[model samples]
Target: MSALEERNRRVLVIDDNVEIHRYLREILEGGAEDAEFDAMDAALFGTGAGPIAMRFDVTSVYRGEDGIEAARRAREEGAPFSLAFVDVRMPAGIDGVETLERIWGEDPEMQAVICTAHAEVSWNRILARLGAPQRFLVLKKPFDAVEVRQMACALTEKWLQEANLRQGEARTRAMLIAVPDAMLRVSTEGRCEDLRAVGAPQLELDDMLPGQAAVAAREAVASVLAGGPTEVFEVEREDLGRLYEARVARAGEGDALLLLRDVTDRRRAELAAAQRQLHEETIAAQAEMMLALSTPLLPIHEDVVVMPLVGALDSRRVEKVREVLIQGVADRGVSIAILDMTGVPSLDAELVDEIVATARAIRLLGAESVLTGLGSGVARTLVEQGADLGGIRIHRDLGAGVAYALRARGGRAARS
Candidate 1:
């Protein structure tokens, strides 16, 4: 025991017998021979011990009146006794039981043990009082002085340990509640035992989690408690504003810690990855579509033919139009070629010449080229530019162009 703490303990024994004082005095200063051995291991099996057993102090008084005076003095001095021993029957103005009441009125935490020759009466009245019955002990007549010392040492030690624990718990609570992390203590069944307002400010009471989150918390609650110090998990949740991901963890001796943090940034990065995947998918689809449109060659029938002219022009589609006309005639062997101008989105003077040149190319291939589906916007543009296209036939629709081709085909067949 530290000198300061040992000197601080005061034990007031209220009894009329002077020999009782001498006896109690010897017990209070008991040596190692007075201790009970290996008999109380039940309370220390799992808890860290030995460190808690080394500090204790004891004092004893011989008279009820004297004991009461000493108790009052101790209280006035601001360091009251930690525990007391009181005999029920005593030669004084008040009895031991009444003196106990007066003593506690001064220091409520003082532990007391009742010493008496008459156990029955003392016990009966002692149990009925406002003082906790468990705090008072019964000592029969003709008890061993050494045994009294042992009990005094044990009970006083127990009371000091309890006082220390209560004070320590209060201090810890102050620290735990003020921590800056979003932390909680969760039970084995996934119920939040306590909440610390850190990362998750809304984690109050029974509302720590919602929606799919509750289910996910349940899944990992067991793994935390599978006989380990702590465990961590990453999970997802959707709140009123957005989706969030979180990292949760368990800590402490019972595997009961729970902690959460907002992981919105991580989730956003994942979303961007998914969008990139979708973009790649769309590109793949468009490529396959272009391949399908180009499969049939020109004049696989005289009735239908399509030509796609493609290339990047100078802010225009010029060579694209010329290729369409040549493909329409040579490949389909049509008497009339419908010049597909759909791919030619814009034009300049050179682009216009490319369209006129395409008509000449169709004639050279032994097929007359008819311009079809020229958007009014493009036709007006071409007319304003005054491009000469008297050589090219004009049709409003592909069907009309096809009819013209068929008519010329009939004429050629008749000549043959």
Candidate 2:
């Protein structure tokens, strides 16, 4: 077992006289050797009448310095002495009071008994040096063996209880450090009782919950104390420019526990994501409107539609043009789609490809595509780029395209 586990019954006796040391040892440890006498006593007077079996591990030291050294060593080894018996006068060394002071300085939990035959130092002087009468007992040189044993047992038990209490407080402090939220224990009247901070240490819980926040927390805590549900509220810190969520719950005895979590970062991320989505949607709607305006589809004649293209056709606008033409032709059920590019200033290979692709898409939907308003500059560029029209009908202007559509419709009517 560890030293601490076995330290409960340990005791120390400090005296220069060998006979005194021998007497204390016999009194403290002699009980175990008196088993035979105990049995006779038990047989004479029933088993209940026998002395209680008690044993203690006692260490004997010769001088005041030796006693202090032993106590310091025991403390460093984590098995400190529960009690010490020191003689008041030690020849050529310090006395009982000095020895006890030095030992207590190292191990404050150790209880001591000052042994003296004559009054070498006044009791008031000892008390003045020690500063407390709680841990020390004065015993005359002719001390009672039973009284010594009783003191040993009682003081050791007190030391163990104090050790246990210290351990419990240490564990509680560790648990508080492990929690991530800032916590405060508040009464129903909104008084802050206790505060603990784990992650958000800058939050001063000692400061009364501020302004409207104080009123909100007080109401919430009062409701909880009255058997209401736990309440949560959001409060913004204007100084820090952040947000926190406070959760208030009943902690019994008219007190409530307030747990605060900083949610500023999460809220900011959500807001930024929403703003980004809104911007993208707004741009998309504006682009759709511009596409419709740029490619205006007008039904100028029966069975024929005219699309007047007006902007320089970048790749994006080219895709827009293709979408408008394909959708317009299918929806209107027009037989001929006349694309009037009179306002288009120039042409490139990529633009020629886009125009051809639009015509192909319209033809697939069972509509014939007609090209008109081709200026000489654009016509020459198309020829130079080796652009292929693939049998798509062409006209010089909108009027010719419409006349062709009417004639074609009339011919089909006659045939039918």
Candidate 3:
């Protein structure tokens, strides 16, 4: 900012003496002759420095009560006085010490200078009343103008620097709150220096994180400090059955940062999904093997083949039977195909129709279809369903069916 637009350096002067107020105004407001002041300033500071470039917005009050009110008002308006000059002997009203106490109540950070006569107020009394001597200084009556000027400059600058530092710290804390996880900064030896957790529960330094997690975190911090790459690892809470993900990275020259987030629910969901997929794949493989077992095609002679049908039949299984039987008859160039069904305990109308369709499909491929081992219930189902079992031979068992198939294939039947 330009010099004219910069913030004012505010100061408050509280004393009953009008001359004291006027003299302070002249000293702090730049009305003195510069040439004479320069020589004195050079002797005082041991260097030839010009007058302070910063300007002071000074407020003067004759009574201690009035000074307290003025300080309060200044603070409320966001332009608090950086320093206050208070006189101990205010005969008309409350003394300087009480005035300062009330004013500090309004703005505790305001730097103070207690102006008192040689023995008017004891330093012990002042220290006892104030408690923090670092915030105020004792300036005896008949103080030199140059000394007062130097004190004001140093104290006001100290106040401003401290205020800036506090603001910076506040901003840093706000940024840490924005992070949605537990965070800790640790020394190279694994001692936690700072901890912040806006999204999770707050953790203590001595207690550290928790259980095995604390040990893992310390190891991660050490690894990062030793120039190892950033590491991510999981720590499970056996008591709670919960898991956490911890990430460690170098924060600076001598410290590392560890961030932690809970991941128990996510891990559980992934494992469940994997198990479901594996179960589905296993069922599919078993179904394929069962289909093959139910429709085993065995060659009994040069031109004859026998297919044993077992288990309950659905539309899907019926289609599988058709595919295997037609493909086998055509590939083998067989003249006779025997279908044995001794293990089939029962049949429905739909299944009987599907069986007739399979036998007709075999006949279309230039093969004679023979059915054997038909249970009484299965024969009754075929009659009830009025199935067209044309151009197909029926026998009582597999041996009888194989003999018929071989005789129809122009080979003599071999008795088994």
Total clashing residue pairs per candidate? 3, 0, 0
Worst 10 residues of 3 by lDDT: 197-206
Name the best candidate (by lDDT): 3
> How does candidate 3 fare on TM-score?
0.55
Superpose all Cα atoms of candidate 3 onto the true structure and report the RMSD in Å to 1 decimal: 9.5
Candidate 1 runs further than 4 Å off = 1-9, 16-19, 26-78, 90-109, 122-136, 195-208, 227-255, 260-416
Candidate 3 per-residue lDDT over residues 1-416, each given as its tens digit: 65423544689999999999988887777664854666688888866354444446789999999999999999999989999999988998999999999999999999999998858479999999888899999998797988888888889888878898889877887787776666787776666644553345434433756667777777778888889999898877687788889899999999888877778888999999999999999999899888877788898886788888877778888888888999999999988889888878888888788888999999999998999999999999998888888788899999888767767656654643
Whichever of 2 and 3 has more lDDT, that candidate is 3
User: Candidate 1 overall Cα lDDT vs. reference?
Assistant: 0.62
Rank ordering of all candidates by lDDT, starting from the highest: 3, 2, 1
Query: Per-model C-alpha lDDT, please?
Result: 0.62, 0.81, 0.83
Q: Which of the two candidates, 1 or 2, achieves a greater TM-score against the reference? A: 2
Q: In candidate 3, which residue pairs get closer than 3 Å at backbone N, Cα or C atoms, i.e. clash?
A: none
Q: In model 2, which range of ten residues has the least summed lDDT? A: 197-206
Q: Which candidate leads in TM-score?
A: 2
lDDT by residue (tens digit), candidate 2, 226-340: 9999999998889889899999999988788988888999999999999999999999999888877887888765567888887587888888788888888888888888888
Could you tell me the lDDT of residue 275 within candidate 3?
Answer: 97
TM-scores for the candidates: 0.43, 0.63, 0.55
The count of residue-pair clashes in candidate 3 stands at: 0
